[model samples]
Target: MSTDLEVRFKNIYPGKYFLSFSKEDLNTYLKFRSWLPGEEVIDGIEKAGESNMNCVLRVRTNERSFIIKQARPWVEKYPQIDAPVERNAVETRYLGLMGEDVELKIQTPELIGSDTDNFILVINDLGGEPFSFLYEHNSKLTGEDCKSMMAYISRLHQLKPVNFPENMAMRVLNHEHIFHFPFIEDNGFKLDDIQSGLEGISWIYKRDKVLKQKIESLGKLYLGEGKALIHGDYYPGSWLKTELGFRVIDPEFSHIGHPEFDLGIMIAHLLMTGHSEEIIPAMSRYSSEQAVDNELIAGFAGTEILRRLLGVAQLPLKLNLENKKALLDQASDWILSGMIRHE
Candidate 1:
């Protein structure tokens, strides 16, 4: 039978309409879900996190609350940056994949409901305390937290790569942001606008022809097909601290690729955040089931640091320009040295 709400949703352009939602819009969206309480009004709905590619919100009622995430064609913060709408579906599949594993579920969020037509996903809201800010002050992470994160990555990598075409789109997008744009001599990212003197830090890497060529080679390796499933964007921003513990979020960039890319990116963030002391310990805790190429991992780590320092995605760091430059120099050393040994 035809209904008023059904007709309403049919008219609401799923892509553009849901960009910023109201309580009424959310109510209409959840009309068909069994979890929604009958005859009860929604209390409030608000955005949950800061994201450049998706709209993440928390919808609440007297009965319960859940997170609603929808991916858009362009970055929310920087509209010029184009991203695939299908990446949200890839994230849903990734959550489904991890949900299948008993241990992995402990370290990840559960998928509750999803609307593929709108590229929106509903998942259990793991309260909004992101560990990314911990990097701002050199906060120490417990051994257990470090171990759980790396172990989760290791477990995911152990799984054979599945055929998911949507993930490839994210991988290509990630490759461009992480490898290509950051090194361009005049690629047009105004780093100083993000922070005073930030642009000066990139002068060395941006002008170095040799470093650019080396980075291009790393980009090629990133584009190569591999067998392990990887959390393509395994950085501080994706890690959340909840009542349960540390839960990894945002696998929209997940893909079948070299496991080292994940490990490298982890170390890259560590080095940039002034947590290099923890690098060896974190690597040791990973204890991958498969053999890992240490040099390749170092190269990936260097590239990630380079990108974060100069690329469109910037981290909130409380470091002086001198310190930022020092980190950049260290990242260059890692890139040129191409060696990371736990021993």
Candidate 2:
């Protein structure tokens, strides 16, 4: 390694914003792992994804390559969004736990190293775009694909982990957006600013006491005692389509909560993208005995749909205002009545 690079990296503080792996750091890390020749050098660094809260980069060399992920104290894009830095440790913990399960290990990236103090996690890179890209393009998953995905997640929840530290920080952060904000009249979000006429629709829903009561009840269930270990954000953005199969990533929001939360979020995204075929069968594949309450699942999914529609964090969906309003109406119906629509 060059002397200048060594000096620059050696002095790196843990809380640096947009923390990324430099070529020297990557080379040194590889050499430390004995994966590189003493003189081998990294050729380039490519950004992996648009992570607003963390830095993810793919480092490549003629010999080998890997991904470096580092979490910062605050969101990179929106400085106003402050979060606990320890969430990185929580993610690392989730990865380690998943590593112990053979099925999840195959579906998850291989964890190489994790420095809890520095909030850095290094793991193998699964190369491909998010499954979301395909969904957005109107591509559908085959029956086998849906089964495989459902089976993979079933294996996770079936483990029923009980002795793990709760990732309360991430869960709490997500709870605000998913449950609290959508029902509040002035939750500090300008919905119309995101898309035209969105604020008016959001206003109508927020002012509905009946809808708010239904959603708040669901929110209470979300914050209640643990039911099972769940991938808190199990939407398409977290599922990557690799040559091998679907690879799940980004479990930062993981928590010991209702398993239905994961299933509900997944179904909600599928609904938004117009891929409504596998809803029932996939749910059946994942359900075992009376473990998951169908009504609770519907309620959670309903809140998820409404939150994504009216809340601050928006998905890159290609729906017109009328279509979105229709979805909102459907979501409101489901939330108010606890009925899931297969259409």
- What lDDT tens digits, residue by residue, belong to model 2 across residues 42-99? 8999888876677678878776777888776556566456677777887898899889
Tens-place lDDT digits, model 1, residues 64-128: 77888887666666555667888888898889988999888878889998777778888998885
Clashing pairs in 1: none
Could you tell me which residue pairs clash in candidate 2?
none
Task: Score every model by TM-score.
Answer: 0.90, 0.90
* Model 2 Cα shift for residue 78 (angstroms): 1.7
- Give the per-residue Cα lDDT of candidate 2 at 205: 84
In candidate 1, how many Å is residue 160 off? 1.3
Provide the overall lDDT of each model, using Cα atoms, as 2-decimal numbers. 0.78, 0.78
| Stretches of model 2 off by over 4 angstroms after superposition | 1-18, 25-40
Let me know the TM-score candidate 1 reaches against the reference structure: 0.90
The clash count for each model shown is 0, 0
